[model samples]
Target: MMKASDLLVRCLEEEGVEYVFGLPGEELEDLLFSLRESEITFIPVRHEQGAAFMADVHGRLTGEAGVCLATLGPGATNLITGVADAHLDKSPLVAITGQGGRERLHKESHQALDIVHMFEPVVKWNSQITDAETIPESVRKAFKLAEFEKPGATHLEFPEDVADEDVTASVLPTRPRVRRPDPDRDSLTRATDLVEAAESPLVLAGNGAVRTRAARRLRQLVEHVGMPVIATYMGKGAVSDRLDASLLTLNSGPVGEAASAMDRADCVIAVGYDIAEHDPKSWNPDRDKTVIHVDHEPAEVYEHYNPDVELVADISATLDELRERLDSVEGPEWCSGLRERIVEDVSRKPDADEPFSVKRTLPYLREAMADGDVLISDVGSHKMAIARHFPSYEPNTCIISNGLASMGIAVPGGIAADLALETNVVVATGDGGFLMNAAEIETATRLDLGFTIVVFNDDDYGLISEKQVEHTGEQFGTGLTNPDFVTFAESFGIEGHRPETWTAVKSTLEDAIASDEMVLVEIPLA
Candidate 1:
């Protein structure tokens, strides 16, 4: 017989888990001890929220269920933001929380709460383990649900006493194979019919297209049919930005060449589109466009998003089938002009005098980084700038939180990217968002991971300030006071730089990357 915590760790090993992120607590002592004897690495983070964010980004990058741990009550509550982020962002994550003994659960136990019920609304599935016999099954089900289609967060609460109990239960072996259903023949044929009949066709890609093999297949379909492709913010790298067929990323408000292309197109083919990324009302205002939806599941019903034909199946398989059905048809000549216009719109250089603008900083940052290097953006005005100006060459390399749009993701997310991909990461965040989870910088230093962080020091919640000024012709309650980031980084044993000129930004970034140490660069706006 073995301890329940030992069996739980064994179960995680069976699922091929490599790491677990969390904070150390008395309630988690047994599990932490078990982790010491196992092959899995336990990453001790400064905060539960930072741990969850790390897991969230790990899941997004690796296509596996990233695991995060916490104690009961406050610890579990602190993890809610990142859990919600993983849920809406469609990343697979398993959140484990330690509770007090089951005996005390009947009373007002210290640090005990109904975490299972609290997590129900945000997770795909949740359970509280009250018996040692349920350890293996609970863990198996949590991973299965978390990594399944339309992946999101799953939760399992283990009471301290239950974790200390001995049991004969063994881990269940994983299923060898799980098959995704194919697109219905009638639906595929109808979708093809709609595409072939239309004079002008456009493709709108979303977060769902960011899956492992989906981007390549989608690119093949776009290239074969010679259609203009527009990506939602989450789908920025679904196709290479350098491709002539690629239109740049779209924002919440439809504008620029992309909006013009959408307006002129007779038919819209939505490939793996998720309305959560951007509302259809913003892009499809009239609800009159003939939309052929191709995704793993049926489109969510909305007044502006009712699809004329839905090919619900595996996205890559559906794209392959669509390509096989279509004959070589010459794309419209107007598509060339639209692509040219989009390229021109995004390629213009900022004036040298505008040293403080994001437009000026982004180009230099891009120049300093390689094509496949990872860039993460926190939710703020800087996020908008990165999404609009940064060009991505590959999928999952340019990370941003669109569905949840959670602040404080960039630093933790950059750490995860560096860990999972073994690549250099550059995180851009506004000053307001940076302070939210700044303690994670020490966590990165402990792990000896090197990444560059650039703080856009506007000393305010720039997005809110912009909106306020736009709406009421004045701003209020968005300003902030900040520390000297250079000195702050020095305190953590990481080098820091403050560049006063736009031209110096690129060289500073290059130096940081060459130093092979984590560095922070603060750019104070004029």
Candidate 2:
């Protein structure tokens, strides 16, 4: 006979989970003890929020369901933000929370709450395990649902007493892959006809295109059709910016040449485009252009996003079919002039002499990083700067939280990216976002992971301050007095540097990446 906790661990192992990010609590003692003897390494994080953020990034990079654990009450509550982030971002994750004993549920119990109800709105699926015999089934179901098409978060709760009960249950083996259906013939023909008839067509790539093999096919279709490609923040790397067809990234506002291109395009081929990444209302206010929606799922209905034709199926397969159908059509040169204008605009560097100007600093950082290196952006004004200026050569190399648009993800996200990819990770964060998960620096040091954290130290919430100044010509409640970041990094036994010049910043970044040690760099904003 095996303990239910042991069976639970076995189920996780069978699913090929390599790591579990979490914190321990009284309700999880049995599960923790079981994990001790398993091959999966349990990462004890400083905060439950940090653990969940780590899992979120792990899922985004690997396409696996990143697993996170927590206990009841406060522990479960702390995991909420990251779980919600994963849900909105469409990152696969399975969050396990331990609960008070089942016997106490009928009466008033210490640290007992209906966590299933709490998580229902955020997750794709969620369930509470009330019987020892159900542990294997619950674990298997959670992973499957989490990693399915349109992946998002799932939850499984284990009551304390049930975890210790002996059970005769076998861990279920993972199911074999199932082939997704091909696009409907009539829909594909209609989409192809619309593209052929349009004078100017543009591709709007989003987070859904960031999956495996989808980027390559999307780039091929865009290049073959000779249409300009503009990416949402989360879709930054789907097509390499070096391509002549690439128009870099789109921002939240009405500015940029990309917005101009969107305004001129008569037809929009939205490849895996999600409204959550960037609202359709912002770009399609007039709702006059024809849209061909290509995704694993149907187009989300919005007044501004009613597609003329929906190519609903596996994204890669749909692209391949479209390419075959349009093989005879000559590539259009309609957007070539706009693409050239955008290229020229982004290539011109800002005045490097300016004090810590993000526009000037990011190009140098891009030069320092090698191809395939990972860059994680925290939410703030810097996110806007990096998304607009930073050039990514490969998919999944530049990570941004556009779905939930959450702050405090970059530091822990950098740690997880380095762990999972063994690549040098650079975290770009504003000071306000950095402090939210700054304690994860210790977690990174403890794990002996190598990554560089760059804090854009403005001593204020720069984004909000800029907005306030724009709205009312004044700012308040966003300023802060901060410690010397160099000293702060030293306190955690990591290398820290404050570079006074752009040249010095580049050299410091090169040295840190070469050394492969955890480092922190603070550059005060101009």
TM-score of structure candidate 1: 0.97
Candidate 2 lDDT, tens digit per residue, 340-371?
Answer: 77666655555558677776777778877887
lDDT of candidate 1?
0.86
TM-score between candidate 2 and the true structure:
0.97
Q: After superposition, how far is residue 182 of candidate 1 from its true place, in Å?
A: 1.4
Q: In candidate 1, what are the lDDT values of residues 293-348, reduced to their tens digit?
A: 98867899899999999987888889899999986555746667766765665555
**Model 1: ten consecutive residues of lowest lDDT:** 248-257
Off by over 4 Å in 1: 252-255, 329-332
lDDT, candidates in the order shown? 0.86, 0.87
